[model samples]
Target: MLRSFSYLTDHTGFCGTIKNSPSDFVVTEIEVTEHSLRDTQAKSLQKPMEVLLGQSSPGLCAQSCDGGGTPVPADQGLRWAGDSCPASPCQNQHESKAELKPGLEDASVLDSLLGKAVSELLNKYACDLKDVWKSKSDANAGTREFSLGPILDKKNRADLHSAIRQKFPFLVTVTKDNEMIVKGNADYRELCQFVTEKETSDFFKFLDAKLENSTFSFEPDGDKEHRKVVHHFINRKFGKLLETKSFTVTDVNDQQNMSIMVRFREKGWSRKRPAGGFQEKQDLYTAFTLQKENLETLEAISFLAAELGVLPSDFSYTGIKDKKAITYQPMVVKKVTPERLKEIGNKMEKKGIRIHNIHSACQHLRLGQLKGNHFDVVVRDLKHHSHDSSADLKKRISEAMENVETKGFVNYYGPQRFGQGQNVQTDQIGLALLNEEMVKAVKLFFTPEDTDDPVNNAKRYFLQTEDAKGALVMLPEFKVRERMLLRALNRYGVNHEGCTKGWLSIPHSMRIFYVHAYCSKIWNEAASYRLSIYGSKVVEGDLVFSEETDETISLNDKVHVVTAAEESAKKYSINQVVLPMVGHSIKYPGNKVGQWYHERLSKDELQTCKFRVSPLQLNIPGCYRPILKNVQNLSYFLEGSEKGIEIEDNYLNESKVSLHISFDLDPSCYATVCLREIMKCDF
Candidate 1:
């Protein structure tokens, strides 16, 4: 059962709009593909397009390559067999110091494909670019040519197409198997080679038209991954579509398909760490679409990285995703071969994790490197109002959606935002931390709940009573971090330094996360207050953010404050302004807003000004985020409609109507807010 939250349905006023189920909500991320800078510009730039084209015809493209070329991603021909190489490539993949072949940087390859010795052509454009053109076989007479520099650096689209096509040919010739036959005269063949083997076949569709026709013409294929392009709605969508499901139904299925998906496309590199021999430093990047629902990003990556003889810390990713949903993200490991990565991925498939689209990256991924996330949530078992007719239900949904689109709603943190809600919330612990109540914070972390498990309750009770020895003994092996804290207490007593060490023992990411949740709680309450008073219109000096700039705000950048004029100039431009995520460097929205933060901090006994700066310090460089989210592509339909729906076979209750709704939201924004506005029910 999802933990319930106060004000969850306050906006929508329909608390139990739809029966809540884990299977009902599905979130799929739209990944940003990063390309290597050293590779041919055409190869790097075509990644996203390559991914989309591969998905265009699942039947046609599935059999084709990933990211064009041979489809093993980047150069798959980095061989391990050689005089210098060990006999077994599989056993010594990490030790194999196979240098990336010259083909990737073979600018001369483009000469044959582009039909021009790039040295002369580049020199014609600008004599200064002489050094940019590499001459593999130059006589040094200054008359030689080979290829172009950082291909996309200054080259325009026309130049790229020209470079892509050494020469434009009249006919697209295909073999009996429908593979396009490469010919010197046909530069279109060269361009087609840049596309997937499946997509290359499509070029022949117009070949019949081109052979008999006067001019070349064909409709552009639809990019497989079509973006909604509108925006996310964190405020009004969530909490409304749900009715708190009872925990009694033990057999209910919350299948972790992650079909709605932890796929990250990290674009950076790490130092190579080989298993046996000195490793060749190569830029290793692999974008994986993980069908893993039960595994954390770190957990799955750690397992695979270990296979490559690297630590989980060696892998870099944009963000971690929910363990219960299907996800795709990019992961970067330096110097790891695609073959080894693929082999481990294939191995993982047996354990319910399917990894795909292994590729190379030029840049390493840091946290928060994302555009946003797309969600396809299904709300089941609509508890219909007795008097409401079918038309009325539809009208209600439409009007609710329209109102949200017009005025927008409060972007409160959802129940799941803090935690499962069964235990004392993280935000509450964060509040304790803010107040310098380390003991209280640690105690909350081990809150004794009246749970089905006695050992857990006993462990919590021992920790609660300061029986550190008992707590340690009672704590199960699964409570690894907690055991460390209890052991510290047992050894050092409840002194300040001991408590600090105990807290510090937790992972750095997690330690900061508690504070983040606290900040989120503060922001949510503050946002709710603003919504109650100001509605959607801008008040004088009220903070606002433009749609375009909001996404750029990071934990590192100073919080953006909207001016009164910026708020008025472009209508919707300054709609959903941000609030600070309370940190040492944060400047509160002065006036009542700023005062509100101080007041809340005071209530928690927290000193507002006290924050640490070191990585170990809790004084984080918190960024600003929109108080309200703008939702896009808002759509809903009855589960019994043309859109597929199913009856609950596991539940003991009668089957009710299912409402399937789909929308997109920004990264980190909760979709529950939109449902809250739609249902108008108190959750």
Candidate 2:
């Protein structure tokens, strides 16, 4: 889709082109430091009790509560008291059944307070817990409630409740007017079953049985959202029990989905503590400054991973820099020694990548773990307006720069987010993934356009003959995803399952790119519409982060919607107004802008609620982005001969001007979008 740019400043924009060469677009990441992290942690510790207690707020946390008690360590496992082992309600119900009988004290207390018949019924209900869990849906399986007929004596109810708690710690009990209510925790049951099944089953009989010393992959049977939920459930409940790496994978339906590979962690893994108080000490991670020219961040990392003999997932960076740029950023690698990295750095330097300033870090770098990026861009082949002299042009450009510095520019995502050329767009593939049209997404991703490259030829060959092995022979080694997918197709057959297995073989980050690009498209359009309609006005229902909130916290929990009273009182400024990126969790504006979001989403056959892909375990819990971003340290100058400059053709001579511009943007802000505002021309 063609992107529309809306400007916040009314000043006329001059025409220019950026990123003519790799050196022309320079980027330097402003990385987060130990001091900043300490400050953030301190602030978090100081949060009000109410905010800390209110965990249900949007974006506060995704994992469900473990029922408000000390979590049992994974290694300790659940212990069943011998006395509490109850007989199964039906002997032939299932080959294996859970034993959930009350202890002697529990039975005696219940029998004395509520009679033998009532106690027997409770025991029978508890015995059927396993069957109930296996039969119920995820939503209903999470919790089960049982109501005991009301007893007149309050003391007896209290005694019964205490006895049940001792026998079944997973059960929560409450008494209301002598009516004792008992509820079973699903997470508790799941954990117990997981441990029991693993212990009882033959180690050599499972799919992961042979993977004793290596990570074993597990593909949950569900959509993306459901998969994600399951992943979180596993992480929260069994994190100590297993070390897992979760990534996007294609399912049998050829749809983007989630899968996790797990391996047994060392004994007492959960007991290990994180580095505390920023004390200088040796660490497992090596942090270094990485400088690269004309290479995408992932491409450089992939090359480095090959040279280092490590997986790409072992390395982490603060952000993805522009592919066609001289960029410097901090990168962290786990378990790799600095000395070893320095050895590889020499080889990498020949490929336009340089590593330096290596040091030990307590933790690995995460995406967006940076303050912002400083840009030194050179806008070349500037075209002046008709009849405008160099002086007039200079004057216009200066005013435009000042206008942006004061009023800011619309924070639209850059064109690179959507991919280049007139072929298939990344967002199109992403939309297909979101719409659960896996076949279409797969085709859009793997099916080559009418390009004459060898890779395209290979793809065409594969499509025509369904010969993955033949295509693999012709495809270049650098075509990682293509080669990997073909191998999977060859092994699994050229079918839906094979296609999904092919996606699973590719890197997780690459798979997420398409979905994120789709979100970026919606964001860019929404931002344009916001600026076009509001024109820097902060209206009622406009969302803004609270004054005390850190802008770095890009979640809905800290977001506050402007009330009519707040708007009338002029409490928020235009810069504070933010727009949603279209997700299931975000709140839309209450006015026409909000209505427009729904309408636009509907056009794509999407709703805010449908942003989640349950089968793929992808949850697009959208976050808010500022509609306007202030230009920091903005400055510019024009360069070029007055006569004219020779164009690329060498024959055509045009009066070309180059505008050298420099600025800093907050992390996640697109410099190209900012340039679009100054030049007022699509690159």
Candidate 3:
């Protein structure tokens, strides 16, 4: 089979070169030895470009002499941008543009150089230049076809790019346009090896087209075989797409500036220590704190630690909350030094930030956490309302929660919301980027063979966006996953690469496991899980015996809740579970009831309601239908308070976010569930 190879170039430069190289336009004259479509090497070669330049001004050639006597070629005006070519290390020193083309029109020369670079790159990669051009021509002549193989997906692309960066950094180009240009360099050569190992060439073609500001969409093709081939290549290189490790810290104390210890499960090269590997299950820890100074922002004690040098680097937080409101989150820090830890404590005290506690942990948090966020909000300003208004609001909230199976909040933009009205959009761009990253990770693990190819075939299994619109749109599924990931990141933010927040963490001695379930239409499927720490299998039937409901079965209720495991058990280290809640109710007239959340539902502020502190239930739109649901939904179990109000089996699913709270004498006596209820108070 004839392999097709192509290269894109600056349009103006391409036109000039095509005009001058009529004789040697085919592959025979300009030789190409490599077949890599991606960045393979970083050598700065300027030979082909030199030849192209000579074709325009023959007088500049060394052979341009008169008579039999040896004569030197006249210096035609043409300046070299830099001193010497980056590719030729031992050759002549590069000439200055002023010296080479002092009198030549500069603009035209720039145009020529652009085209020359493209031609040079093409000849360098396409050993059989004639075959590549013919293939491209055939593609153009045959139905204007383009192929959207799986490799173009965001996740796969990210993986390929990451590999290129690690293996061949110099070949990568970061242009103002965000377009990655791979000139001849070590990275470029590695990319060729990476793609060739995948046993496919389609992805390379796509990358080549992208380099020229074109896309696979330009010549649309429907044969997915190429995509599958690329996918196989990706799978061969990367294993599991979504693999994460979590650590539990036991010595967490908000008061002492102690460090929390943690480790990983699968193991890999540690950014903190190069000596670490994937086999020995790494072990390390850091010191930090999480505080809800404001209702919106959950500032970490490690923020100061990073400034003071307690931890190795700043840290990584999942999300940034509002500065005006009080919030709580999780964070993680990598390795830290003792001197840096003391400095961190001093800084926190100076800044009036308290360190709650620290503990030893077994691993680093990759994603997911215990339950969801518990939001306690206070709404100011009051209007004339009957005593029943609170009760009605509560009722409405309850009904609304059950009906949607997702959580929602008042249109209060938490600093991240971007759109407006019916078109209101959230911080989806960030979510989209995360999804792209996940896809890339999957590709990287499952298809290491195709590490260099540009197209990411693994995207087909997950949600994907178009070529130009990627990293901008977040599907509902991605959004939900992102929320959980963000929570974990925030809770354990630490000195890490490419993270937003510094280091942060959460301390909890008690451990519990919740089964994350999914429901779609009438059928629901739950994937089995094993002990994260001890590697033991857990069965759903062993956890929940059975549940009795009083109300008539509704669409939401129609979904079966197969108790996978106990909500709270010491044996399980997993903290939270993700479940998809959906109701058959619509926006219009229905038998469904609703309630007001994040606010006191009724004036019965004195009424004591008993509730249990079940895990927080985060409700998000169906992965397929997010736009239909305006707000990201979340709810949790607020069973009872310390006062012990007689609680029913299910008070109100809508009012599930509220639970009574009380403080006995010490702050340690504070109950997370009770605190949740108080936060919902209208006061």
TM-score leaderboard ranking? 2, 1, 3
Tens digit of lDDT per residue, candidate 1, span 510-605? 676678778788777777666556555555456543221111122223234546664566333334456666666456674477778788878876
lDDT by residue (172-290, candidate 2, tens digit) is 56544345677775455554543443422221111112122223445434455655654576667545344454556567887865555444432212233333422232335788999
List candidate 2 segments past 4 Å from native. Answer: 1-3, 41-45, 48-284, 386-391, 447-451, 549-557, 640-657
**Sliding window of 10 residues with minimal summed lDDT for model 1:** 226-235
Q: Name the lDDT value of residue 318 in candidate 2.
A: 58
Greater-TM-score candidate between 2 and 3: 2
Q: Model 2 Cα displacement at 252 (Å)?
A: 54
**lDDT of candidate 3 at residue 215, scale 0 to 100:** 16
- In Å, residue 526's CA in model 2 sits off its true spot by 1.2
Task: Rate residue 145 of model 3 by lDDT.
Answer: 18
User: Can you write out model 3's per-residue Cα lDDT over 1-683, one digit (the tens) per residue?
Assistant: 00111111111100001102112111101111123211222111100011111011111100110012221112211111121111122122222111111212233332243355643443344344324433565433222112112332433333333333223222232221123333323323333443442222333322211211111111121334543443344333322211111112123343322111111111121223233222222234443344434222222433454464443233433334333333344445545443445455555655434443454322233211222233333221211133223423334334433433332211111112221121212222212222223232222212212233322232222223222123112212222222233344334431132122210112110000011011221011111111211122222322211111111112123222223333233332211211221212211101111111101212222112111112222212221111011112234333333233433543333322233211121110112212112222211
How does candidate 2 fare on TM-score? 0.63
How many clashing pairs in candidate 2? 17
TM-score of each: 0.54, 0.63, 0.26
